[model samples]
Target: MFEKRELAREHLKFENNLFAQRLVPWPLLNAPFEGSWCVIAPGTASTPHAHHEYEIFIAMKGKARLETGGKSIDFNVGDIVHFTPGTDHSIVNDGTEPFEMYSVWWDAPMAENFLKKHVATEN
Candidate 1:
């Protein structure tokens, strides 16, 4: 079976106070699909953004809310949400504990550029 540990680790610049650790890739699978395990720390939110790719989210643990188009939908463990491409969305942890979820992307570019201009950061 295909496993995530076998896949290379790549970090994505998703949003402010948030980032994603990509675990699985489409190239590893027999078919075209990408899988990832995202860990959202407490007091943080996956920034509002959109991509030109079909996306789906499966809540694995903790409490969180999915925000899209200025509306919020509370999702818990075992909840699944499927939306089309370019649908502006983000996730926030409204609870005390960290939120974990499994995300997948299909038939689209793996990495997306959220920042247009260079912002000098103090390292």
Candidate 2:
């Protein structure tokens, strides 16, 4: 079986953070391994929060300041970052260009709960 989904850029909001096309749905993937394409618009920053699951962040384009545990680091194209459970993190656009990324949440339920609870909020 095969499934294809056409994804477009949209706004993703969690609490007070704003994300563009963040936490995209991956219906094709099996459970316990769901993922989504994440995007951060220019001059935008995500809400600093922590998750109960492990997440892998892949940078597709542009650069941004990745903040974790009150520490900020610059990330650019082809960069990969990983966040474990209880690690507070957020991404902020440090340049004038859009930052694109694809992230995967190993814990499907945790990711779904967060995305469903706090997506579609406008900045």
Candidate 3:
């Protein structure tokens, strides 16, 4: 079983100058992980937030800065970042172009358990 979604048809939610679209866990897909697509306008940033789920962000376009753990990291197109559960983070777009990224998140415990089982089987 697989699913497909067209980006052009997806509705984007707006906050300030930031645009976001929920891609996974939608009505048709009851996935354990959640996913989203975001575009941050120049000089804008996503709200700093944290949750119980581990998160991965894959930069799709432009340059930006990732603020987390009291430090700022330079992020560019094609860069990928990971944040452990409950780590506060946000993406700041200081460049003239929109910072585009895809985000995927899932429960930390669930992921750990899955990895443990797979590793145990391999061992």
Candidate 4:
């Protein structure tokens, strides 16, 4: 089965004062990974948080600073960032316009098992 949805503002949900929309593994689609589109208003920051899943962020628009591992890394459109499991991180939108990004995450154990199975088959 295939599930498709338009990434529009009407689909966004307000969470923690940020606008976000869950895409993959959504109600109509079941997958191993979870994905979301997030937008942070200018001069705002997402809450610092950590989880047990590995995550990657793809900057889509505007500019922001990623605060993680006690370091602040600036990122802009076309930039990609990865976070290891349990790494506390947050995005701060310091630019004049809203910051947009896509986030994809999966459990560490699930990824490890997938690699084991796929790598062995390839070998």
Question: By TM-score, who's the top model here?
Answer: 4
lDDT minimum window of 10 residues, candidate 4: 24-33
Task: Estimate every model's Cα lDDT from 0 to 1.
Answer: 0.71, 0.72, 0.83, 0.86
Clashes by residue pair, model 3: none
By TM-score, rank the candidates, best first. 4, 3, 2, 1
lDDT of 3 by residue, 24-86 (tens): 445545455778888998989999988888899999999999999999999998899999989
Q: Kindly list the per-residue Cα lDDT of model 2 for residues 77-117, writing each as its tens digit.
A: 89999998899988899678878777776775765755654
The parts of candidate 3 lying over 4 Å away from their true place are: 15-17, 108-123
Alpha-carbon shift of residue 109 in model 2 (angstroms): 6.4
Those runs of model 4 whose alpha carbons end farther than 4 Å from true positions after fitting are 24-28, 108-123
The 10 consecutive residues of candidate 1 with the worst lDDT sum are 113-122
For each candidate in turn, the TM-score is 0.70, 0.71, 0.78, 0.81
- Candidate 1 — which residues are off by over 4 angstroms? 1-16, 25-28, 108-123
> What lDDT tens digits, residue by residue, belong to model 4 across residues 27-122?
544455778899999999988999988899999999999999999999899999999999999999988999999999999666675677666667
RMSD of 2: 8.7
- Which candidate's lDDT is highest? 4
Give the candidate order by descending lDDT: 4, 3, 2, 1
What's the count of clashing pairs in each model shown?
Answer: 0, 1, 0, 0
Task: Give the Cα RMSD of candidate 3.
Answer: 5.2
The true-versus-predicted C-alpha distance at residue 6 of model 1, in Å, is 7.3
